[model samples]
Target: MARLRVFLHSRLVLSGLLAVTLLAGYLVFRYFYEVAGDFPFSQEMLLVFIGAIATVLITALLLIQQTDLELRKEGQVLLLDRKAQIYNALIDHIGEIVEKGRLDPAALADLRVLNHKLAMVASAEVIDRFSDVLARLDTAGHDVLVDEAERREIMRAVAVLTYWMRRDLLGRIDTEDEEAVLAAIKANNADLE
Candidate 1:
Protein backbone atom coordinates (compact mmCIF):
# COMPACT_ATOMS: atom_id res chain seq x y z
CA MET A 1 0.00 0.00 0.00
CA ALA A 2 2.81 2.40 0.86
CA ARG A 3 4.51 1.47 -2.40
CA LEU A 4 1.41 2.42 -4.39
CA ARG A 5 1.86 6.10 -3.41
CA VAL A 6 5.41 6.40 -4.82
CA PHE A 7 6.30 8.89 -7.63
CA LEU A 8 6.69 6.00 -10.10
CA HIS A 9 3.01 5.16 -9.63
CA SER A 10 2.11 8.58 -11.08
CA ARG A 11 3.68 9.22 -14.50
CA LEU A 12 2.75 12.91 -14.58
CA VAL A 13 4.33 13.58 -11.18
CA LEU A 14 7.50 11.72 -12.18
CA SER A 15 7.80 13.61 -15.46
CA GLY A 16 7.30 16.97 -13.74
CA LEU A 17 9.90 16.04 -11.10
CA LEU A 18 12.48 15.07 -13.74
CA ALA A 19 11.79 18.29 -15.67
CA VAL A 20 12.40 20.38 -12.52
CA THR A 21 15.61 18.49 -11.76
CA LEU A 22 16.98 19.09 -15.29
CA LEU A 23 16.07 22.81 -15.17
CA ALA A 24 17.77 23.25 -11.78
CA GLY A 25 20.91 21.47 -13.02
CA TYR A 26 21.12 23.71 -16.12
CA LEU A 27 20.66 26.87 -14.04
CA VAL A 28 23.42 25.79 -11.64
CA PHE A 29 25.78 25.16 -14.57
CA ARG A 30 25.06 28.65 -16.01
CA TYR A 31 25.71 30.29 -12.61
CA PHE A 32 29.05 28.51 -12.14
CA TYR A 33 30.19 29.35 -15.71
CA GLU A 34 29.45 33.10 -15.33
CA VAL A 35 31.06 33.40 -11.85
CA ALA A 36 34.23 31.47 -12.74
CA GLY A 37 35.03 33.25 -16.14
CA ASP A 38 34.92 30.78 -19.05
CA PHE A 39 32.13 28.25 -19.83
CA PRO A 40 32.49 24.53 -19.15
CA PHE A 41 34.64 22.30 -21.40
CA SER A 42 36.36 20.64 -18.50
CA GLN A 43 33.26 21.16 -16.33
CA GLU A 44 30.95 20.16 -19.16
CA MET A 45 32.84 16.87 -19.39
CA LEU A 46 32.51 16.58 -15.63
CA LEU A 47 28.71 17.11 -15.90
CA VAL A 48 28.53 14.38 -18.57
CA PHE A 49 30.51 12.07 -16.28
CA ILE A 50 28.12 12.82 -13.38
CA GLY A 51 25.12 12.20 -15.65
CA ALA A 52 26.55 8.80 -16.64
CA ILE A 53 27.06 7.92 -12.97
CA ALA A 54 23.44 8.93 -12.22
CA THR A 55 22.25 6.72 -15.11
CA VAL A 56 24.17 3.79 -13.67
CA LEU A 57 22.67 4.39 -10.23
CA ILE A 58 19.16 4.47 -11.68
CA THR A 59 19.78 1.21 -13.57
CA ALA A 60 21.05 -0.48 -10.39
CA LEU A 61 17.98 0.66 -8.44
CA LEU A 62 15.67 -0.76 -11.14
CA LEU A 63 17.52 -4.06 -11.16
CA ILE A 64 17.28 -4.28 -7.38
CA GLN A 65 13.51 -3.71 -7.49
CA GLN A 66 13.08 -6.38 -10.19
CA THR A 67 15.18 -8.85 -8.19
CA ASP A 68 13.13 -8.16 -5.06
CA LEU A 69 9.88 -8.85 -6.91
CA GLU A 70 11.21 -12.13 -8.31
CA LEU A 71 12.42 -13.33 -4.91
CA ARG A 72 9.05 -12.53 -3.30
CA LYS A 73 7.25 -14.50 -6.06
CA GLU A 74 9.53 -17.49 -5.55
CA GLY A 75 8.96 -17.44 -1.79
CA GLN A 76 5.18 -17.44 -2.30
CA VAL A 77 5.41 -20.39 -4.72
CA LEU A 78 7.52 -22.37 -2.26
CA LEU A 79 5.10 -21.68 0.59
CA LEU A 80 2.18 -22.77 -1.60
CA ASP A 81 3.97 -26.04 -2.42
CA ARG A 82 4.57 -26.73 1.28
CA LYS A 83 0.94 -26.10 2.13
CA ALA A 84 -0.20 -28.47 -0.66
CA GLN A 85 2.05 -31.23 0.65
CA ILE A 86 0.70 -30.92 4.20
CA TYR A 87 -2.89 -30.96 2.93
CA ASN A 88 -2.18 -34.06 0.83
CA ALA A 89 -0.67 -35.79 3.83
CA LEU A 90 -3.90 -35.10 5.74
CA ILE A 91 -6.09 -36.66 3.02
CA ASP A 92 -3.77 -39.62 2.78
CA HIS A 93 -4.04 -40.21 6.53
CA ILE A 94 -7.81 -40.25 6.21
CA GLY A 95 -7.50 -42.79 3.41
CA GLU A 96 -5.44 -44.99 5.72
CA ILE A 97 -8.12 -44.80 8.41
CA VAL A 98 -10.80 -45.73 5.86
CA GLU A 99 -8.79 -48.67 4.56
CA LYS A 100 -8.10 -50.00 8.04
CA GLY A 101 -11.73 -49.43 9.12
CA ARG A 102 -10.55 -48.10 12.48
CA LEU A 103 -8.75 -45.25 14.19
CA ASP A 104 -6.37 -46.80 16.75
CA PRO A 105 -4.31 -45.08 19.46
CA ALA A 106 -1.28 -44.87 17.18
CA ALA A 107 -3.44 -43.40 14.45
CA LEU A 108 -4.71 -40.77 16.87
CA ALA A 109 -1.11 -39.94 17.85
CA ASP A 110 -0.18 -39.62 14.18
CA LEU A 111 -3.13 -37.25 13.72
CA ARG A 112 -1.92 -35.09 16.60
CA VAL A 113 1.52 -34.95 14.97
CA LEU A 114 -0.11 -34.05 11.67
CA ASN A 115 -1.97 -31.26 13.47
CA HIS A 116 1.39 -29.90 14.59
CA LYS A 117 2.63 -29.91 10.98
CA LEU A 118 -0.65 -28.27 9.95
CA ALA A 119 0.00 -25.46 12.41
CA MET A 120 3.10 -24.54 10.45
CA VAL A 121 1.17 -23.94 7.20
CA ALA A 122 -2.59 -24.25 7.57
CA SER A 123 -4.95 -21.34 8.12
CA ALA A 124 -6.18 -20.94 11.70
CA GLU A 125 -9.66 -21.96 10.52
CA VAL A 126 -8.34 -25.26 9.19
CA ILE A 127 -6.47 -25.98 12.39
CA ASP A 128 -9.65 -25.42 14.38
CA ARG A 129 -11.64 -27.71 12.07
CA PHE A 130 -9.04 -30.45 12.39
CA SER A 131 -9.00 -30.11 16.14
CA ASP A 132 -12.78 -30.50 16.13
CA VAL A 133 -12.39 -33.72 14.18
CA LEU A 134 -9.88 -34.96 16.76
CA ALA A 135 -12.18 -34.02 19.60
CA ARG A 136 -15.07 -35.89 17.96
CA LEU A 137 -13.00 -39.05 17.62
CA ASP A 138 -11.74 -38.71 21.17
CA THR A 139 -15.31 -38.98 22.50
CA ALA A 140 -16.28 -42.01 20.42
CA GLY A 141 -16.40 -45.22 22.51
CA HIS A 142 -15.47 -47.45 19.56
CA ASP A 143 -12.39 -47.53 17.31
CA VAL A 144 -14.59 -46.74 14.32
CA LEU A 145 -17.83 -44.89 13.73
CA VAL A 146 -20.05 -47.95 14.28
CA ASP A 147 -23.47 -46.37 13.85
CA GLU A 148 -24.83 -45.13 10.53
CA ALA A 149 -25.85 -41.78 12.00
CA GLU A 150 -22.42 -41.32 13.61
CA ARG A 151 -20.69 -42.27 10.37
CA ARG A 152 -22.77 -39.80 8.35
CA GLU A 153 -22.08 -37.06 10.89
CA ILE A 154 -18.34 -37.75 10.75
CA MET A 155 -18.49 -37.68 6.95
CA ARG A 156 -20.23 -34.29 7.02
CA ALA A 157 -17.60 -32.96 9.38
CA VAL A 158 -14.84 -34.26 7.09
CA ALA A 159 -16.55 -32.67 4.07
CA VAL A 160 -16.80 -29.33 5.85
CA LEU A 161 -13.18 -29.61 6.93
CA THR A 162 -12.15 -30.30 3.34
CA TYR A 163 -14.13 -27.29 2.12
CA TRP A 164 -12.27 -25.03 4.55
CA MET A 165 -8.95 -26.58 3.53
CA ARG A 166 -9.65 -25.86 -0.13
CA ARG A 167 -10.54 -22.25 0.67
CA ASP A 168 -7.40 -21.93 2.77
CA LEU A 169 -5.10 -23.24 0.02
CA LEU A 170 -6.73 -21.11 -2.69
CA GLY A 171 -6.41 -17.95 -0.54
CA ARG A 172 -8.80 -15.11 0.39
CA ILE A 173 -12.38 -16.11 0.97
CA ASP A 174 -14.31 -13.60 3.06
CA THR A 175 -17.36 -14.18 5.26
CA GLU A 176 -19.83 -13.93 2.38
CA ASP A 177 -17.93 -16.65 0.55
CA GLU A 178 -17.94 -18.63 3.78
CA GLU A 179 -21.70 -18.29 4.13
CA ALA A 180 -22.12 -19.66 0.63
CA VAL A 181 -19.87 -22.61 1.42
CA LEU A 182 -21.74 -23.38 4.63
CA ALA A 183 -25.05 -23.23 2.74
CA ALA A 184 -23.80 -25.71 0.19
CA ILE A 185 -22.51 -27.98 2.92
CA LYS A 186 -25.82 -27.74 4.75
CA ALA A 187 -27.73 -28.78 1.63
CA ASN A 188 -25.40 -31.71 1.06
CA ASN A 189 -25.30 -32.81 4.71
CA ALA A 190 -29.10 -32.91 4.74
CA ASP A 191 -28.93 -35.55 2.00
CA LEU A 192 -26.39 -37.52 4.06
CA GLU A 193 -28.65 -37.41 7.12
Candidate 2:
Protein backbone atom coordinates (compact mmCIF):
# COMPACT_ATOMS: atom_id res chain seq x y z
CA MET A 1 0.00 0.00 0.00
CA ALA A 2 2.81 2.39 0.89
CA ARG A 3 4.64 1.43 -2.30
CA LEU A 4 1.49 2.12 -4.30
CA ARG A 5 1.21 5.55 -2.71
CA VAL A 6 4.89 6.24 -3.44
CA PHE A 7 4.38 5.14 -7.05
CA LEU A 8 1.34 7.36 -7.43
CA HIS A 9 3.19 10.33 -5.93
CA SER A 10 6.22 10.05 -8.20
CA ARG A 11 6.18 12.87 -10.79
CA LEU A 12 7.92 10.76 -13.42
CA VAL A 13 5.45 7.89 -12.94
CA LEU A 14 2.45 10.21 -12.95
CA SER A 15 3.62 12.02 -16.10
CA GLY A 16 4.30 8.76 -17.89
CA LEU A 17 0.88 7.41 -16.89
CA LEU A 18 -0.74 10.63 -18.09
CA ALA A 19 0.99 10.28 -21.47
CA VAL A 20 -0.07 6.66 -21.78
CA THR A 21 -3.67 7.46 -20.79
CA LEU A 22 -3.91 10.29 -23.32
CA LEU A 23 -2.44 8.07 -26.04
CA ALA A 24 -4.88 5.28 -25.26
CA GLY A 25 -7.81 7.70 -25.18
CA TYR A 26 -6.79 9.18 -28.54
CA LEU A 27 -6.45 5.74 -30.08
CA VAL A 28 -9.91 4.72 -28.88
CA PHE A 29 -11.45 7.95 -30.19
CA ARG A 30 -9.67 7.50 -33.56
CA TYR A 31 -10.89 3.95 -33.84
CA PHE A 32 -14.47 4.97 -33.22
CA TYR A 33 -14.34 7.99 -35.54
CA GLU A 34 -12.19 6.67 -38.44
CA VAL A 35 -12.47 2.89 -38.49
CA ALA A 36 -16.03 2.32 -37.38
CA GLY A 37 -17.20 5.70 -38.70
CA ASP A 38 -20.06 5.42 -36.21
CA PHE A 39 -19.01 8.17 -33.81
CA PRO A 40 -22.20 8.80 -31.87
CA PHE A 41 -21.42 12.37 -30.87
CA SER A 42 -20.48 15.33 -33.10
CA GLN A 43 -16.79 16.38 -33.09
CA GLU A 44 -17.76 19.67 -31.48
CA MET A 45 -19.62 17.83 -28.74
CA LEU A 46 -16.57 15.59 -28.18
CA LEU A 47 -14.39 18.68 -27.81
CA VAL A 48 -16.81 20.16 -25.27
CA PHE A 49 -16.80 16.90 -23.28
CA ILE A 50 -13.01 16.82 -23.30
CA GLY A 51 -12.85 20.43 -22.17
CA ALA A 52 -15.28 19.76 -19.28
CA ILE A 53 -13.32 16.69 -18.17
CA ALA A 54 -10.13 18.73 -18.24
CA THR A 55 -11.73 21.44 -16.13
CA VAL A 56 -12.96 18.97 -13.54
CA LEU A 57 -9.54 17.29 -13.34
CA ILE A 58 -7.84 20.63 -12.92
CA THR A 59 -10.27 21.61 -10.16
CA ALA A 60 -9.76 18.36 -8.31
CA LEU A 61 -5.95 18.68 -8.60
CA LEU A 62 -6.10 22.21 -7.18
CA LEU A 63 -8.27 21.12 -4.26
CA ILE A 64 -5.88 18.26 -3.46
CA GLN A 65 -2.90 20.65 -3.54
CA GLN A 66 -4.70 23.10 -1.28
CA THR A 67 -5.58 20.36 1.21
CA ASP A 68 -1.95 19.19 1.31
CA LEU A 69 -0.78 22.73 2.05
CA GLU A 70 -3.37 23.18 4.81
CA LEU A 71 -2.37 19.93 6.48
CA ARG A 72 1.31 20.93 6.35
CA LYS A 73 0.52 24.31 7.90
CA GLU A 74 -1.54 22.71 10.65
CA GLY A 75 1.29 20.33 11.50
CA GLN A 76 3.70 23.26 11.73
CA VAL A 77 1.31 25.13 14.02
CA LEU A 78 0.97 22.16 16.36
CA LEU A 79 4.74 21.76 16.51
CA LEU A 80 5.16 25.47 17.14
CA ASP A 81 2.71 25.38 20.05
CA ARG A 82 4.52 22.48 21.62
CA LYS A 83 7.86 24.21 21.21
CA ALA A 84 6.53 27.41 22.72
CA GLN A 85 5.30 25.61 25.81
CA ILE A 86 8.63 23.90 26.30
CA TYR A 87 10.59 27.09 25.79
CA ASN A 88 8.31 29.02 28.13
CA ALA A 89 8.71 26.43 30.84
CA LEU A 90 12.47 26.59 30.57
CA ILE A 91 12.49 30.36 30.67
CA ASP A 92 10.10 30.50 33.62
CA HIS A 93 12.12 28.02 35.63
CA ILE A 94 15.30 29.99 35.08
CA GLY A 95 13.50 33.22 35.85
CA GLU A 96 12.34 31.85 39.18
CA ILE A 97 15.88 30.90 40.14
CA VAL A 98 17.16 34.30 39.10
CA GLU A 99 14.40 36.08 41.00
CA LYS A 100 15.27 34.22 44.19
CA GLY A 101 18.99 34.76 43.63
CA ARG A 102 19.54 31.22 44.72
CA LEU A 103 19.01 27.60 43.76
CA ASP A 104 17.36 24.67 45.52
CA PRO A 105 17.33 20.91 45.24
CA ALA A 106 13.82 21.01 43.79
CA ALA A 107 14.80 23.52 41.09
CA LEU A 108 17.72 21.37 40.08
CA ALA A 109 15.46 18.34 39.83
CA ASP A 110 12.94 20.33 37.81
CA LEU A 111 15.71 21.48 35.52
CA ARG A 112 16.68 17.89 34.79
CA VAL A 113 13.10 17.12 33.83
CA LEU A 114 12.98 20.23 31.64
CA ASN A 115 16.20 19.11 30.02
CA HIS A 116 14.51 15.91 28.89
CA LYS A 117 11.60 17.85 27.48
CA LEU A 118 13.97 20.25 25.73
CA ALA A 119 15.92 17.33 24.27
CA MET A 120 12.80 16.22 22.46
CA VAL A 121 12.00 19.55 20.71
CA ALA A 122 14.97 21.88 21.04
CA SER A 123 17.27 22.64 18.15
CA ALA A 124 20.98 21.83 18.51
CA GLU A 125 21.80 25.51 18.96
CA VAL A 126 19.15 25.87 21.66
CA ILE A 127 20.31 22.77 23.47
CA ASP A 128 23.94 23.89 23.30
CA ARG A 129 23.11 27.33 24.64
CA PHE A 130 20.89 25.92 27.36
CA SER A 131 23.70 23.65 28.48
CA ASP A 132 25.66 26.71 29.42
CA VAL A 133 23.06 27.36 32.10
CA LEU A 134 23.58 23.91 33.51
CA ALA A 135 27.33 24.32 33.41
CA ARG A 136 27.09 27.65 35.24
CA LEU A 137 24.88 26.10 37.89
CA ASP A 138 27.31 23.24 38.30
CA THR A 139 30.18 25.66 38.60
CA ALA A 140 28.35 27.65 41.23
CA GLY A 141 27.48 24.39 43.04
CA HIS A 142 23.99 23.42 44.27
CA ASP A 143 21.84 24.99 46.99
CA VAL A 144 24.06 28.05 47.22
CA LEU A 145 23.34 31.77 47.19
CA VAL A 146 24.15 33.28 43.80
CA ASP A 147 26.69 36.12 43.91
CA GLU A 148 26.39 39.17 41.67
CA ALA A 149 29.02 37.94 39.20
CA GLU A 150 27.52 34.46 39.09
CA ARG A 151 24.05 35.94 38.60
CA ARG A 152 25.29 38.10 35.74
CA GLU A 153 26.84 35.11 34.02
CA ILE A 154 23.61 33.17 34.41
CA MET A 155 21.63 36.08 32.97
CA ARG A 156 24.00 36.33 30.03
CA ALA A 157 23.75 32.59 29.40
CA VAL A 158 19.97 32.75 29.63
CA ALA A 159 19.99 35.59 27.14
CA VAL A 160 22.01 33.50 24.71
CA LEU A 161 19.63 30.60 25.25
CA THR A 162 16.64 32.88 24.70
CA TYR A 163 18.10 34.15 21.46
CA TRP A 164 18.65 30.63 20.13
CA MET A 165 15.20 29.53 21.27
CA ARG A 166 13.64 32.42 19.37
CA ARG A 167 15.43 31.40 16.19
CA ASP A 168 14.54 27.75 16.67
CA LEU A 169 10.88 28.53 17.26
CA LEU A 170 10.83 30.68 14.14
CA GLY A 171 12.23 27.74 12.14
CA ARG A 172 15.40 29.61 11.34
CA ILE A 173 18.77 27.95 10.91
CA ASP A 174 20.91 29.59 13.61
CA THR A 175 24.61 29.45 12.78
CA GLU A 176 25.85 32.79 14.06
CA ASP A 177 27.37 33.31 17.48
CA GLU A 178 25.09 34.66 20.24
CA GLU A 179 27.81 36.84 21.84
CA ALA A 180 26.37 40.12 20.50
CA VAL A 181 22.87 39.25 21.70
CA LEU A 182 24.28 38.12 25.04
CA ALA A 183 26.21 41.39 25.46
CA ALA A 184 23.11 43.46 24.77
CA ILE A 185 21.02 41.41 27.19
CA LYS A 186 23.74 41.62 29.82
CA ALA A 187 23.82 45.38 29.50
CA ASN A 188 20.05 45.60 29.85
CA ASN A 189 19.99 43.25 32.85
CA ALA A 190 22.69 45.36 34.52
CA ASP A 191 20.18 48.21 34.86
CA LEU A 192 17.61 45.88 36.41
CA GLU A 193 20.22 44.51 38.75
Candidate 3:
Protein backbone atom coordinates (compact mmCIF):
# COMPACT_ATOMS: atom_id res chain seq x y z
CA MET A 1 0.00 0.00 0.00
CA ALA A 2 2.85 2.36 0.78
CA ARG A 3 4.41 1.50 -2.55
CA LEU A 4 1.12 2.27 -4.27
CA ARG A 5 0.90 5.64 -2.54
CA VAL A 6 4.46 6.51 -3.53
CA PHE A 7 3.72 5.55 -7.12
CA LEU A 8 0.50 7.56 -7.22
CA HIS A 9 2.14 10.63 -5.70
CA SER A 10 5.01 10.43 -8.14
CA ARG A 11 2.59 10.11 -11.04
CA LEU A 12 0.62 13.17 -9.95
CA VAL A 13 3.78 15.20 -9.53
CA LEU A 14 4.99 14.19 -12.98
CA SER A 15 1.62 15.01 -14.53
CA GLY A 16 1.54 18.46 -12.91
CA LEU A 17 5.10 19.16 -14.04
CA LEU A 18 4.22 18.06 -17.57
CA ALA A 19 1.23 20.37 -17.66
CA VAL A 20 3.31 23.35 -16.50
CA THR A 21 6.05 22.49 -18.98
CA LEU A 22 3.57 22.40 -21.86
CA LEU A 23 2.06 25.74 -20.84
CA ALA A 24 5.53 27.32 -20.68
CA GLY A 25 6.45 25.88 -24.05
CA TYR A 26 3.26 27.23 -25.62
CA LEU A 27 3.86 30.69 -24.13
CA VAL A 28 7.44 30.72 -25.51
CA PHE A 29 6.22 29.66 -28.93
CA ARG A 30 3.55 32.41 -28.93
CA TYR A 31 6.13 35.08 -28.08
CA PHE A 32 8.35 34.15 -31.04
CA TYR A 33 5.89 32.97 -33.71
CA GLU A 34 2.79 35.17 -34.20
CA VAL A 35 2.50 37.45 -31.14
CA ALA A 36 6.05 38.99 -31.22
CA GLY A 37 5.00 42.58 -32.11
CA ASP A 38 1.42 42.38 -33.43
CA PHE A 39 0.16 42.08 -29.83
CA PRO A 40 3.18 41.70 -27.58
CA PHE A 41 1.43 43.82 -24.89
CA SER A 42 -2.16 42.73 -25.58
CA GLN A 43 -4.09 42.62 -22.30
CA GLU A 44 -6.64 40.16 -23.74
CA MET A 45 -3.95 37.58 -24.63
CA LEU A 46 -2.23 38.09 -21.28
CA LEU A 47 -5.51 37.45 -19.40
CA VAL A 48 -6.15 34.24 -21.38
CA PHE A 49 -2.61 33.02 -20.70
CA ILE A 50 -2.98 33.76 -16.99
CA GLY A 51 -6.31 31.93 -16.93
CA ALA A 52 -4.72 28.84 -18.47
CA ILE A 53 -1.94 28.95 -15.85
CA ALA A 54 -4.53 29.31 -13.10
CA THR A 55 -6.36 26.23 -14.40
CA VAL A 56 -3.14 24.20 -14.26
CA LEU A 57 -2.47 25.39 -10.72
CA ILE A 58 -5.98 24.39 -9.62
CA THR A 59 -5.51 20.91 -11.09
CA ALA A 60 -2.20 20.52 -9.27
CA LEU A 61 -3.81 21.58 -6.00
CA LEU A 62 -6.50 18.93 -6.38
CA LEU A 63 -3.91 16.22 -7.01
CA ILE A 64 -2.01 17.27 -3.88
CA GLN A 65 -5.19 17.08 -1.82
CA GLN A 66 -5.84 13.54 -3.04
CA THR A 67 -2.32 12.52 -2.09
CA ASP A 68 -2.71 14.02 1.36
CA LEU A 69 -5.87 12.04 2.02
CA GLU A 70 -4.23 8.78 0.96
CA LEU A 71 -1.19 9.42 3.14
CA ARG A 72 -3.35 10.13 6.19
CA LYS A 73 -5.26 6.90 5.71
CA GLU A 74 -2.00 5.00 5.37
CA GLY A 75 -0.76 6.47 8.62
CA GLN A 76 -3.91 5.38 10.42
CA VAL A 77 -3.50 1.80 9.20
CA LEU A 78 0.12 1.75 10.37
CA LEU A 79 -0.92 2.83 13.85
CA LEU A 80 -3.58 0.13 13.98
CA ASP A 81 -1.05 -2.48 12.93
CA ARG A 82 1.32 -1.43 15.68
CA LYS A 83 -1.44 -1.64 18.28
CA ALA A 84 -2.55 -5.08 17.08
CA GLN A 85 0.98 -6.48 17.17
CA ILE A 86 1.54 -5.27 20.70
CA TYR A 87 -1.79 -6.66 21.88
CA ASN A 88 -1.06 -10.03 20.33
CA ALA A 89 2.33 -10.22 21.99
CA LEU A 90 0.76 -9.43 25.35
CA ILE A 91 -1.91 -12.05 24.84
CA ASP A 92 0.73 -14.65 23.93
CA HIS A 93 2.72 -13.91 27.07
CA ILE A 94 -0.35 -14.16 29.28
CA GLY A 95 -1.27 -17.50 27.68
CA GLU A 96 2.21 -18.83 28.37
CA ILE A 97 2.01 -17.82 32.02
CA VAL A 98 -1.41 -19.42 32.32
CA GLU A 99 -0.38 -22.74 30.73
CA LYS A 100 2.92 -23.00 32.60
CA GLY A 101 1.26 -22.07 35.90
CA ARG A 102 4.31 -20.12 36.91
CA LEU A 103 6.12 -16.86 36.23
CA ASP A 104 9.59 -15.57 37.16
CA PRO A 105 10.67 -11.98 37.53
CA ALA A 106 12.06 -11.95 33.99
CA ALA A 107 8.77 -13.18 32.47
CA LEU A 108 6.86 -10.62 34.52
CA ALA A 109 9.14 -7.86 33.28
CA ASP A 110 8.55 -8.84 29.63
CA LEU A 111 4.78 -8.87 30.20
CA ARG A 112 4.98 -5.43 31.77
CA VAL A 113 6.67 -4.08 28.64
CA LEU A 114 3.86 -5.52 26.54
CA ASN A 115 1.23 -4.07 28.85
CA HIS A 116 2.85 -0.63 28.69
CA LYS A 117 2.68 -0.60 24.91
CA LEU A 118 -0.99 -1.52 24.92
CA ALA A 119 -1.76 1.06 27.59
CA MET A 120 -0.27 3.72 25.41
CA VAL A 121 -2.10 2.78 22.19
CA ALA A 122 -5.36 1.14 23.21
CA SER A 123 -8.64 2.84 24.12
CA ALA A 124 -9.49 3.89 27.68
CA GLU A 125 -11.62 0.82 28.29
CA VAL A 126 -8.87 -1.42 27.02
CA ILE A 127 -6.34 0.25 29.25
CA ASP A 128 -8.58 -0.29 32.26
CA ARG A 129 -8.97 -3.93 31.33
CA PHE A 130 -5.18 -4.35 31.21
CA SER A 131 -4.85 -2.63 34.55
CA ASP A 132 -7.22 -5.20 36.04
CA VAL A 133 -5.15 -8.00 34.52
CA LEU A 134 -1.92 -6.53 35.89
CA ALA A 135 -3.41 -6.27 39.35
CA ARG A 136 -4.52 -9.90 39.24
CA LEU A 137 -1.10 -11.05 38.08
CA ASP A 138 0.56 -9.11 40.87
CA THR A 139 -1.70 -10.69 43.46
CA ALA A 140 -1.32 -14.29 42.18
CA GLY A 141 2.44 -13.96 41.70
CA HIS A 142 3.15 -13.61 45.41
CA ASP A 143 3.47 -17.40 45.81
CA VAL A 144 5.57 -19.19 43.16
CA LEU A 145 5.54 -22.74 44.52
CA VAL A 146 2.31 -24.43 45.50
CA ASP A 147 0.05 -27.53 45.14
CA GLU A 148 -2.27 -28.41 42.24
CA ALA A 149 -5.14 -26.46 43.76
CA GLU A 150 -3.05 -23.35 44.12
CA ARG A 151 -1.80 -23.70 40.55
CA ARG A 152 -5.36 -24.02 39.30
CA GLU A 153 -6.28 -20.95 41.33
CA ILE A 154 -3.52 -19.00 39.64
CA MET A 155 -4.67 -20.25 36.23
CA ARG A 156 -8.19 -19.09 36.99
CA ALA A 157 -6.96 -15.68 37.94
CA VAL A 158 -4.87 -15.35 34.78
CA ALA A 159 -7.81 -16.51 32.66
CA VAL A 160 -10.11 -13.91 34.12
CA LEU A 161 -7.56 -11.22 33.50
CA THR A 162 -6.88 -12.06 29.84
CA TYR A 163 -10.54 -12.74 29.04
CA TRP A 164 -11.58 -9.27 30.09
CA MET A 165 -8.63 -7.66 28.38
CA ARG A 166 -9.36 -9.47 25.14
CA ARG A 167 -13.03 -8.57 25.35
CA ASP A 168 -12.37 -4.88 25.77
CA LEU A 169 -9.64 -4.82 23.17
CA LEU A 170 -11.82 -6.67 20.64
CA GLY A 171 -14.39 -3.91 20.91
CA ARG A 172 -11.89 -1.43 19.51
CA ILE A 173 -10.93 -3.52 16.46
CA ASP A 174 -12.91 -3.73 13.23
CA THR A 175 -15.12 -6.77 12.67
CA GLU A 176 -12.66 -8.60 10.43
CA ASP A 177 -9.68 -7.83 12.63
CA GLU A 178 -11.56 -8.77 15.78
CA GLU A 179 -12.04 -12.25 14.39
CA ALA A 180 -8.35 -12.54 13.59
CA VAL A 181 -7.29 -11.50 17.07
CA LEU A 182 -9.75 -13.90 18.67
CA ALA A 183 -8.58 -16.75 16.47
CA ALA A 184 -4.99 -16.05 17.40
CA ILE A 185 -5.87 -16.00 21.07
CA LYS A 186 -7.68 -19.30 20.74
CA ALA A 187 -4.70 -20.87 19.01
CA ASN A 188 -2.43 -19.63 21.75
CA ASN A 189 -4.76 -21.01 24.41
CA ALA A 190 -5.02 -24.49 22.86
CA ASP A 191 -1.67 -25.38 24.39
CA LEU A 192 -3.24 -25.16 27.84
CA GLU A 193 -6.21 -27.34 26.88
Alpha-carbon local distance difference test for all models = 0.71, 0.76, 0.67
Candidate 3 lDDT over 59-113, as tens digits, reads: 7667777877888889888877787788778868876776677778878899878
Worst 10 residues of 2 by lDDT: 3-12
TM-score of each: 0.70, 0.76, 0.56
For model 1, the stretches where C-alpha displacement exceeds 4 angstroms are: 1-40, 141-147, 185-193
Q: Write the per-residue lDDT of candidate 1 for residues 94-173, one digit (tens) a residue.
A: 65664565777787788878888999998988888887766655554274543455555556666778888888878876
Candidate number of the best TM-score: 2
C-alpha lDDT of residue 172 in model 1: 71
TM-score of 3: 0.56
Candidate 1's displacement at residue 39, Å, is: 5.2
Give the deviation of candidate 1 from the true structure as CA RMSD: 6.6
Question: What is the C-alpha local distance difference test score of candidate 1?
Answer: 0.71
Candidate 3 global lDDT? 0.67
